[model samples]
Target: MVRKEKLDSMFNAFSIVSGGNYVYVCDMKQDLSRWSKSAVDYFGLPSEYMENAQSIWNEHLHPTDREYFNESINAIFAGSDNNHTLEYRARRLDGEYVVCVCQGVVIHDDDGKPEYFCGSIKNHDSVNYIDDVTNLRSLYGFLDDLKSAFWKKQELDILMIGVEEFSRTNDIFGYTFGNRALRKLGSLLLSEFRCEGQVYRMDGTKFAVIAQKSSIQRLSEIYADLQETCAKEFYVGSDRLTLSLCAGALHLERFSVSPDTVYSCLRFALHESKGNHHGELFEFQEVVIDESRNSLTRLNEIRNSIVDECVGFELYYQPVVDAKTEEMCGAEALIRWRNNDYGLVPPFLFVPILEQDSLFPELGKWILREAMICGNRIRAKYPNFVMNVNLSYAQLERTDFVDVVLDLLKATHFPAKNLCLELTERCRLLDVKLLQNIFVRLREEGVRIALDDFGTGFSSLGVLRKLPIDCVKIDRDYVLNIQSNKEDRNTVKFISQLAEAFNAELCVEGVETAEMRDMLRKFNVTSFQGFYYSRPVPIEEFCVKYSC
Candidate 1:
């Protein structure tokens, strides 16, 4: 303890720079701590300088967070980690609980043993909500603060950074590790923009920065530095990894709309950053606001159309042909929407928005009923033919879903054997047990189940094995490049073999040419569906074109 004066001098520095935050220094060996007045008063501590400050602080912790806080403190004292960062709820003097972020580091002596702990605490209220996972401001907080700043007319620049391949990381390392890595990244971002702005942890591997009085040019420069930092490998515990980040930025002053509108534009920019720009920064342009969104007015149109008996909605059928005889064996029902204003709007434009929508179940029921009605017409000619209709998670989640399907089949006078319910790629989100039960119930009635967009999404083989599948429809991504992509061809062959092993027939989608058909036919696929067979047409047109 010969350098006692040096320790005192360092502690004195915190007094000068508390910056309206709670600053504290703990003498680990002595079990004493000195807190700034704000911390003492807010936390309702008995004294500014006191023994057992940790226990005193612990007493004020929210009941739900007390155990976690105690465990972390014990680990810190045991010298398990070099950094001390925690987020927890603490009771305030006003009898209110506030989410507080505590950040500090363990100061080691010459012997490399823990000697002191120093930190600051920032209380985040509703105006600056906090994320429990990362301890950063959450997207809700981002919107809250953005609205406040916007109303005040404070010029602001918003920057969004999305982590690439985060899902793959979670799949490999598990969600517990993914959450820790996100926390580490959040702290890194805090350090990067501490003096300049507020950083937020947005939903799903995306982070946002909102700096008052900042410009796009300045934010762009900041993003470059952040991108460079992320390129270098970082560690959460002993695990090391490098992250690729794509960025999107919006200058709020450039638009006169609400904060939500501004965020919508920024989201579009981030999508471009990931899909087209390969992690480069994509800025929101005024022209894109109109062209890309076509206005979210479509969301309104969808709701209204669903209410009006699905007025603008239509279903088109594309044939799935037999590999051996080239006869039309089945058809996939594809949904179409045609508004008077937009005229033939793409499914990609509205389907995604409505997939989780409350009205989707209603719309989904409409598609199934219509497909069954039309399938009845087709089955009159082709008795053994199958009519495939895509299923959505929204529809599947309903308790009445299985009942709806059975009722539609009976009401339409359609044979269950002639209809196949193809599970869309998103159905991967459902629990395996739930999916199995649904598939089994449908199969009990002789209705077929096909896993749509096979060889894509999480656990393709696993899904095929777990579910009672009658068919596996290969995704267009694989079939489109089967001619040149060796990996694609190998994947198709592997899936085909796997399907056969599971006693499931294989159908290849995106067969736009005869060569593709010949190539895929060599791989044990029984059916093909694509432009080569025929683009999806009206049900009447399908009957006339593929008539027996």
Candidate 2:
């Protein structure tokens, strides 16, 4: 509970605020109400301080609105409410009925009953701070206060609350009902805080409470209560059910930071809560290590893109042509991320960093489903064309990976035989037994498997002997210099011979110039993928350049 002096300090702070509002305060113990000078002048009140204020206010309420006003106030004095908010018509000094929006919060005593109530009354014409649906302050209002607190360099703590599976709510009961549910949630949060000073309806089915007066520890306690309140049956309009809530919090002690940075970190924290914490509150920690901080921030952005429906990340297809026909036979789907700040980021730069991240499996699934669906479209042009996707170790280890793959194939209606999953040297780190099991299962479903960067891993020979792969993608290193270096030529010769022994097709990578392509022909390479044919491109461009 906020002490009387603190609430009084807050009321005084608002009384001098620039916004056009008529502030009011109520001492629940004394049953006395105090109106600001503006409110007294506008209402033509008998005095600034009124005895039996409720009865007096009730007398001035528009006749038709008397019932609602009485009930709302009755709820407050009865200790049934921690916050008060309503809209109604009230008769003014000129005897004109004016629509007014009243929003106030109850500051509690030790027993959690309202000790004081401080709120503002504003005319309907100036409601920019209020959210139409929730009646709590809008995101605009939240941002305005956030900026104000930030620029003032005050110590701040903020909680970003999101309803898990809220779209399902909309699906169950149309969006109109979902909005009502959201309003109920907003009111619940506002009540838990027992104040209208900070709680706000954020954009996109989320809520926020930014506080300079509350400590991080206090916010945590409040969040725990909010979570508990959601666990019980929460009535929304008429329907009642439990709401799943997740929150991300940040505590900043100093003012030497940017709100934009805080906003990103807080959002990242929320994403972490939803994705990894099972709806638990996650607090963004300031990293002391420079390298770790940069890495963390970079990965956060990448993960954010993935969560945003795989935005900024796209598949680029590189055509693989049969060496003899010198025509495209298949295409390898490579991913490229075009970050807003960094532009087109190369795959090597982002993929390696993400391969170890837990979210990589999700991104990997996106890549596979996207590649398969796109490849399915291309099969219309050429029935035998294959689409190859590289499997990250992160994806390979997911327990549901095989099931996910098979399900995607069925859903996308892409032929399993037209798809190939490639494994790089990193896949060597996974258990050989697991790799063998996955390879066999996929092969049984008519999906081909290939060892990418075949000669790059330390255990290249071991992987070839143990894993059942249909193709050996010779590392680009050997092919890059085959025309000039005898060792490169010999290495290509050795890999080709090994492919023959393993009965796997040999696809030499990095066959850049015509000279290199021709030089590689001596080694009995079955396919070639390099700039000489085409660099990786979008699905539409791939079809155009390698048209059937």
Q: Which candidate is the best by lDDT?
A: 1
Worst 10 residues of 2 by lDDT: 287-296
Query: Number of clashing residue pairs in every model?
Result: 0, 0
Q: What is the lDDT of residue 430 in candidate 1?
A: 76
Per-prediction CA RMSD (Å): 19.4, 18.5
Candidate 1: stretches off by over 4 Å = 1-293
- lDDT of model 2, residue 319: 88
Off by over 4 Å in 2: 1-296
Q: TM-scores across all candidates?
A: 0.53, 0.50
- CA lDDT of 535 in candidate 1? 96
Clash number for model 2?
A: 0
Model 1 global lDDT (CA atoms, 0 to 1) = 0.81
lDDT of 2 by residue, 1-548 (tens): 34445545666876887277788778888776777777777777888778788888888887766777788789888888777666666777888766676888888879876788778887753446778899888866665565556444677788888888788889988999988888888878878886523888877888888887887678778888888878786887678767888888888764444445455556656766776687888887754435334434554566678778899898999989999888788999999988766578678755754664556788898999999988988899889999999988789888899999999999999999999999887666588899999989999999999889877653478878998989999888877777779998888888889999999999988878999988888887899998998888888887777563
